[model samples]
Target: MQRVRLVDVARDAGVHPATASRALNPAVVGEVSQATVQRVRRSADKLGYVPNTLARGLRTSRSYVAALVIPDITNALFPPIVRGAEQVLTEAGFTLVLTDTNSATEVERSQIASLRAHGVDGFIVATASWHDPLLDELATEGFPTVLVNRRCATSALPFVGGDDQQGVRLCVEHLVGQGHRDIVHLAGPSNTSTGRERADAFRAAMRDHRLSVRQTVIECSAYTEQAGAAGAARLMARRRPFTAVVAANDLVALGAMDALGSAGVTCPRDYSITGFNDLAFMDKLTPALTTVRVPFTEMGAHAARRLLEWIADQPPTATQSMLPVELVVRGTTGAPPVD
Candidate 1:
């Protein structure tokens, strides 16, 4: 079918094309009679006349293509964020072009170049390392890029991250409340902001609680299940009489759980544990993990919104967006075994 034009609706409604156009759009058409608005809508529905987003975008010099770049989509934490961003972008008359770097630096650079070459209006980036040279390179181009869950040290780039301090505070406080004193902190790779922030938060919370948490911090290779299991095993053998574990992320915590199971140690009876990001299936495990739930969806959507500001040639409202986090109390943490 040929593209439905406003003229068709105007001819059908016996009104001028401009009047029909004004009657159809909510902004200018509110002054038109409600009956006319309803009629235009009815005609539009009957004709299956969906507005052409590309034509409008081209006229405005806004291609309406938004880039959503992630480190790895295979991780359970990303699907919800993508779904939420797509919902908001669709309502705003924008298109999303997703790219995955698969955690490779060269691939990520190539992806960025491709997105920039394609004339994407802005970017919502969910991947950041402490020493990300690619982001610094992108920063010079004046493209609107919002970082999510990770950030560069410089204040120039905008970012959206979880309230990691609060999340770790809750986990530490919960462990303290459960009468644990010796806890192991499973630190993630320090190159990422999430890892560093959560690790720092755990230490601060522990000290603030006045708990003598004899901590043995082991840095994991990556936020992978195998790394977590290996780190947990090392901590178990290396630490002396530790009663609880606090992992930087949920993936690490699950790995720790597996290591503990292999050793035939019962969770909460022999030791309690905590994790972050509260991924799906956390509760279904033999002992449901107590974890922090970050607002990844809200952060993703906010990044999209901030990127729009860049596309509009306006400065982002804030350099960083810190979404709130909540602690989910589950089966993993409990009182230490009595003396």
Candidate 2:
């Protein structure tokens, strides 16, 4: 059998090829008559004519493609998130382009420029920093942008993340209730909202619970296993030893666990440890990790939806959503062992 073309379908449907093309595009669905649309659709089905997305988009000024900007795709936490985003966008007939800048600002800038040159319909940026100049420029340039799992100091952009304040409160309350009054929080860099907010929440939660934390918080330069190990070591070097450690991220917590192991310490028995994000392998560690579980997949789906809205020129109201978190009780957390 021979392949079908738009012209062949349009001729059978008693419409122009351009009219048939518009009917096939969801973005222009409203402009065409429903009866005519059904006719054109039937004709298309009979002919099995594949719509040329590139050609149609040239006529309609749409690419039906979105770019996802990731800081570090190698992180285990990102796979599920990307899967969720792609699942949603795929249903909407939008192609998702995954780009990693390795968390480098310069690389991110160049990549964003390249995506713009390719004419992406919008962007879902998962690498937002506190003061992201590239993000601001993109937003100001009127490109539809959705920030996933991070935020900027300025609230002009749509942001999605876990409830940091609530998650921290729950974590601190759990630690204090477990008889861990001397707890250390392994924090991320203060430059990003997740790091800054979680750190501040830790301080507030500690104060609210009347826990006396005698040591300074350990802020890792980046959210990586190596950084976590280094940061945990620094906290241990201080003169005072805390009975528990609450890590800002799972990698950091796992790193802290490694550091403790290297120093001949045991978790829950020697010092209770808790982590955030409940990433993969948390439960399979030497002692299962007790960490907060944030809905990474949900955040990704929400980001996809938000980006679609922008592509449709129906941007959501500039707002921030803080999803709920669950604290998983595992082997890593327990009552402070008797000295």
Q: Give a tens-digit lDDT track for model 1, residues 72-163.
A: 88888888778777877775668899899887888988998888887888888878888887787768766678888888765368987788
TM-score of each: 0.90, 0.89
What's the distance in Å from true for residue 179, model 2?
Answer: 1.4
Write candidate 2's Cα lDDT for 135-193 as tens digits. Answer: 88877777888998899886478888889888878888998888888888889888899
lDDT of each: 0.81, 0.86
lDDT of 2: 0.86
Error of 1 at 162 (Å): 1.3
- Model 2 stretches astray by more than 4 angstroms: 6-49
Deviation in angstroms for 329 in model 2? 1.3
Model 1: how far residue 234 lies from native, Å: 1.7
